[model samples]
Target: MDTTKKLPLEMVYHWESSSPDSLYMTQPIGHGKVVEYTWGRAVNEARRMAAYLKSLNLPEKSRIGLISKNCAHWIMTDWAIWMAGHVSVPLYPTLNADTVNYILNHAECDVLFVGKLDDWDMMKPGVPESVRCISYPLSPSNNFETWDDIVAKYPPLEGRVERDPDEMATIVYTSGSTGRPKGVMLSFNNMAFAAAGGIETLGVGPSERMLSYLPLAHVFERTFVELGSLYSGFQLYFAESLDTFVQDLQRARPTLFLSVPRLWVKFQHGVLQKLPKEKLERLLKIPVLNKVIKKKVLKGLGLDKVKLAGSGSAPLSNDVLDWYRNLGLELLEGYGMSENFAYSHMNKPGRTRTGYVGESLPGVETKISEQGEVLVKSPASMMGYYKDDEKSREAFTEDGFLKTGDKGEIDEMGRLKLTGRIKEIFKTSKGKYIAPAPIENKLMSHAAIEMVCVSGANQTQPHALVVLGEEIRPKAADEAFRKELEESFKSLIKDINKTVDPHEQLAFITVVSDEWSIENSFLTPTLKLKRNVVEDAYQARVDSWYAKKQPVIWQ
Candidate 1:
């Protein structure tokens, strides 16, 4: 793949001039209502925004904060920021006040662009009085300049602002599960390489369609949805709300779809709700009937048109991957981190490995460190962690490979199978180290389990804290439900223990009543479980759970 390509702003200009009337984005505003933006209109709006920012006469390369959900204006604001010669800092829409304040202050942002959000009241206190503010379609409760008024007031900026490929473009903050978020500085060249390589690897084109529902702040979504659309000229659709997700997906009929492991699991559960797993599996065995069944299932889920389906941001279970394959969808699993712009490795179509995050992309290098850490060297690697010289130095090796902090082994085929995070491995009282991720992945395959955390620390044996799936919660009070759950879990545990080392065997399963969510601090905005938070909340009860002398304990 060619590492040198036009930057994002250049692509915007190219598309604006070549495909002025072409649909760039379709945004859902309300029930059965949508607002479309053509390439010409989007560029004109961004130019106006750039003029307004230039009028303020901020310093060159000033840091600007963008906080919002996925929308047309969000992408427009990003382009405008770059066009105005400023750096973009994106904040997760679900972030709390403390983290929000930390990012704004640490990045030293001169202005903020607020857009459609769920909880502005929770985020308002974080914005400093010194920083100027601009609101998008929806304004925050605090008085601030609105996007409409600014565009109406300023004429579109004349002439394109030239930018070097190596210049800084955005500071992407990691969604930290254990500590404070770190800002990863990405340059235009880095993003250009990633976008170009991704297009080559995925074979997406201008005619491709996609539904953009994931948080735009996440690197996976930002690179795939925002940058991918700009480079490929694909039609982008935005979901109106969570309530309208199914309708939105149906309307778009996307040719490419991406989702995290949790959402994939939910998709499986939703299917099983209508057809029992056993019956579905049996029906899938019939030669002629299987085609009909698969078509029906895919059409019902609004993924019948998907040409490429992917799962990332975390490890996906082989069980889930196989289930999707059984329905005629090749669910590919890829691996990357915020530090690499998510360009490390991906499973190519028709050449996928069941359990590995496929071969490294073209022009990307990967090797296992002496301590079994996956290290990568690629054009898409970040410049460094912003404002943290020590961390930036520690992240790379003497040879310049970025230390991924993930323990893994490369196969003969050069595929990477991640074992677990080095720091997440725990020692049991029996003096054996146990990697919890593999066990958690296995437990999560159970129909009733939504999320699971395995921990032993200094205990006799490792045990799991399980959160019941949404479908099982309502029936929890019934004796029949309890009996069914006990039977299912007993068989599940027995089967799982048979495949693991003796030391890694689970002692018991503790089912918790509470749901894990971002609001409660149990999950990150990306929907990854916070193991530290989970252990802190339930460590004291581990002994009590073991003392019950039962295989299953309901809390």
Candidate 2:
């Protein structure tokens, strides 16, 4: 586990000396073009960038903003920031101008590193003119100082540089599903403890491969993929774009693949697009054919080499897990939040519950609060929120456990089954409280449904708003297809309703055509639904939909 309290930059130096020529990262540039970086070269570049950053002569421990999509340089820039004695502040690549302006000003950033983005034009204005901007390779514009220019202008930092374990490392802002995002400050000690524990517990090594596609701004990607690389030295691959994601996966052939619930569902839907679910299930019953079918399906998705698959950021349907399991894949679920460096509970091999998030990792302590909220205490827990003393004080217990807003239950086996968020639970007019998560998971089992939100506080009965999968969108023009879908959803709702209490039962399921996305502010960067934005968009019309007395209503 290498429990020595070493910062990430020191670990990078260790790896540079230990295995300098080892391939560290592969980045796809465009059509059939790639760039590979050895550990030595990667560190040399980071060192040079660090030298350039030092040349700016910024104050010690300054906040440096990095707004970039996933790329090899994104990782290097982060290392350079840490190496240059500054705290890195990563902003979500998909954020709008307002958010970009808000974060840079809020963090009091002095320099901004811009890299690989689709919305650089929209986000460019938000970067404060005073905050010196540096552009990475493959960046959309040439307006800012280029990374190559700086690297070519300076030499690599001569001697070894390191930060104290207690030094502030980074400030990761929340996804703002609750409200305005809060900056969660984490120290080098927190990162070290998390990386050491997670890598040792997972038994990952340098030989393993991983594809990094999720936003690096999120804590999960930062804590696991980024830091785990320093601790375990696994080779990483950067995806080019959405159009080439499949090819990128095929190129990497990642042995360890982690994804969110939304992408997992999309992948399944992609498979079902070619083959009917009923026919696939029927063929799986035959032993030899089932093997061939699973192999072909997995290979098509480029997940054939995956030894460990994972889903997180939100609750996933058990059916999705079961589908992957039936194909002999080890898909596990984990539970954690930004405040804890995302080093908390993870379902382990041979000790897993299908729907539960599984037991705590070696150093994580978990318990249910009086309000059924999940409270966690771990070595990876954040120092506190930056510039918000009141919220920071409110976020933890008197004894120092971080109050995870999630509502969960622990079984005898210590498995944690999250029900919903304490803030998400609402009461019906009948005075019975409803936790929408379980019901929503049950409803998501239907293959045609993409996203579902269960809501109706103070109403007679709870209702649901569902976004249909893309697979059915083409068929929607056909009257027969639409009728069949409404009937299918009606049956799905009737079946699910029988399992929950009457108050928790959904009065109707409405199919909404509105897209929920980060651009629209309907979803967070991690694809978590922003409940407030969602309801506010349609709450005024919901009463009329309810009065229609239809089992499945369409909007």
Candidate 3:
């Protein structure tokens, strides 16, 4: 298939002239305040920063590290990096010092841009003193040369800078659900093709307003949201913080929204907290009242204006998808990984299946490997893992289709249903191998259960560890609620086991005392469970727990 060399930088030049005064970005600056960046203003600032970046005299295509949460400057810095002919390497804002240090040194970054973050103090020590640091307006107190100073000192670059499509644009490190993250190299054409194709397929245009709360470091946000904006000239809004998400989202009133299953579940629980599930379901049976209640609920959650919505990064329970759909929201599930720039597959507006992640997008090919792994070929495929030839070589088949590492089944109509990760399958002592993802998803459907990880490798039968929902945990302290919750877990398990084969039945479920998070090294930045870490953490007590408890073991 033939593809254009049109790059995001070129798109910026287009918007600079075509719609110079359009609202390009809306960034929250705390204290109920916001700052707007018009297309002209964004381009002008990016060019000025490009001028400053050029002054640094770094080698051509040098890797510059960008560490920040989603913000206006984060996107601007990325554009500036391209305009200055450098490669950007963005680190997750929540990364530990060691990981931050490893990526910086591994990428051989000559400069680093420190943007808005909550853990700058912890991450700063990881940054090498040799690398030049540039601080953003919202950055923590640092002595580095400031972004404001650079914009004031240097004039915007003389002319619209153009980029060669094949040049390395950025090095995106995987979230590392299992091991150390690998830097995935993407070219200008790689990002441009992805942004352009997704825009055309999804019918995104200048009128589309999207909220950019997801980390731009990941391919999903960068390709779909950041670069998508450059391609479609959409108005992008930045969410300030987790505490003010509802208010911030309300302000943006995004026409399209994308979120993870975890957040979506939280939203469901948030709704259920105010109106019990039984009551809400009963009210929905009454036609007019149902519509009114749905509107009120969505408006309360700042999602009433969303014309299109998506859940990705992990598999969302069908129950939650149905819940949002019941509220008259068009929530679709998409399937893609960081390696493919998240352009692999997505459900269309009218052609959606409940559990399936949708058919392959136009200009994409998919096939099942002999081992049952999902393989894909897309125009937006990455250049391969940066500086890791062995791993890169192993990532694809001889025919060049990327080994997605996910096990899935494609229906006759071309829809894809992900079963589990090929690597996540574990064996029991009885010689039966079990896939935990599908089982974990069953328990995840219950509102009282927040996160579930099914484990028990080399044991008689596999079991699961679950963290109670935020609201459910406190209520569990009451003896009455505790008994009621245990009975429900028993029923949930019994129901789930009836669906799976006998060997795959869960032995018991342990209620984990603590929650998994990036900070705790139990979950990846994308919220995928670190299976190995989790298994190791609970290994010692595995035998003892089964002996003491009947079915639902409390940690």
Candidate 4:
């Protein structure tokens, strides 16, 4: 991988000119149909869009907002934004109107590109009348200037717009798991360095295939799927919808796959539903049967040909990691935040530590602060938080390392295991501190539980608020099911308490009926629990339940 490519567009042009007829990406349109694009065609379409954007004659470095789910058009729009010398501002498709308004206004966006939206009517109220609007492929309605009309009206862009290496390229907003989103300003050099380092570190090449289903608005997906494709010249595939995900995965057969821990857990649960745990264990003990079981499982999951698999965006349970490994799949866990362009750390291919996020990547530096916060310095680090000097200044240490707020420790081999967020650690009346994440991870392993939150704050002992899994939800009303769930949870809690310190042991478990979702403001777009929101919703109930002195409380 050549690090000399100064910009992402340069890499696009390289592939386009060198292998114009090679397949670049395929987008599922629906009804068992997919539209494929070659490198030359993709670049040409992007250039056409860039020509239209240039015709607008907007001010230099003007902010352009892109709101959509993952698709081929999303990448085209992003490339067009940079090609026209504008800064791209991406919004999650799941964002509410208020957040959309806030981010668009805060970013001072002059134009908005809408594509493949779930609810455009709900989002339209947030777009200012002054901001120009454009519609892209697969748009539900022709309410805005259509992408086809613009391309037909304008010629291809004459040449690449000149940009300084340090010039702002994009402003990616954080997923606000803790609070309101803040825009993280990334420069051309930031992305250039990250793309180069990632390609070299992961050993991705032109022949590698990737499926893009994760929200492209998030830096994790953007860095690995979008930027990785450009730098490595890999073929990219897009999932049409959740209903067709399995079919899409089977079609793509991605060589490099990345997913969050939640999805990985869901996959494990899906497999367990087909093959009971005891049966799986017994088969693994037989040498010949283990290979048959492994091959069948991988093929069913559409991961039979996957060369590398990774989980990030949240901590993965070591149990989940080991389960996949038993099936001959090594699921590497990585660690990074939006502030650093997700360039901090990753588990290398051959050297993986089950529970730990791997060592710092090349061109990156990591250290533990006196307060145990993970600090990172890398060429890919964001320039600053856009339009917020005070917050940006507070984000970094005096020596310029980004303060990653996550509490963690590095082992002798330099693998880092995060304990929890500094603000998330709570203290009990016994005056002992407890990290909720590890405890929550343990509780989530129970087959009946889908999500768990541990809180004690001002109480004598911490208790958990859990949401029942989908498989167990309908059975909750049956007497036998209820009795079984109670026993399972009780046994799970007792087993967890034996392994943890006294202060960290959960006192009781309160099972809730309501499902937690992004629409309900309980989870972020990335599917991470909004801890503050969860605590606020259940803290009082937790206090009341703790006073009852029952081992299990069902709501």
Model 3 gets an lDDT of: 0.89
Considering summed lDDT, which 10 consecutive residues are worst modelled in model 3?
Answer: 1-10
Residue 236 C-alpha lDDT in model 4? 97
Q: What's the CA RMSD of model 1 in angstroms?
A: 1.3
The window of 10 residues in a row where model 2 has the poorest summed lDDT is 1-10
Residue 526 C-alpha lDDT in model 1: 96
Ranking by lDDT: 1, 2, 3, 4
At residue 380, what lDDT does model 2 achieve? 89
Q: Over the stretch 26-85, how does candidate 2's per-residue lDDT look in tens digits?
A: 989897899999999999999999999998899999999999899999999999998899
TM-score, model 1 to reference = 0.98
RMSD of each: 1.3, 1.0, 1.5, 1.1
Whole-structure CA lDDT of model 1: 0.91
RMSD of 3: 1.5
Candidate 1 lDDT over 252-323, as tens digits, reads: 999999999999999999999999899999999999899999999999999999999988999988888999
Candidate 3 structure quality by residue, lDDT tens digits, 341-363: 88899999988888899989878
Give TM-scores for every candidate, taking all chains together and pairing residue i with residue i.
Answer: 0.98, 0.99, 0.98, 0.98
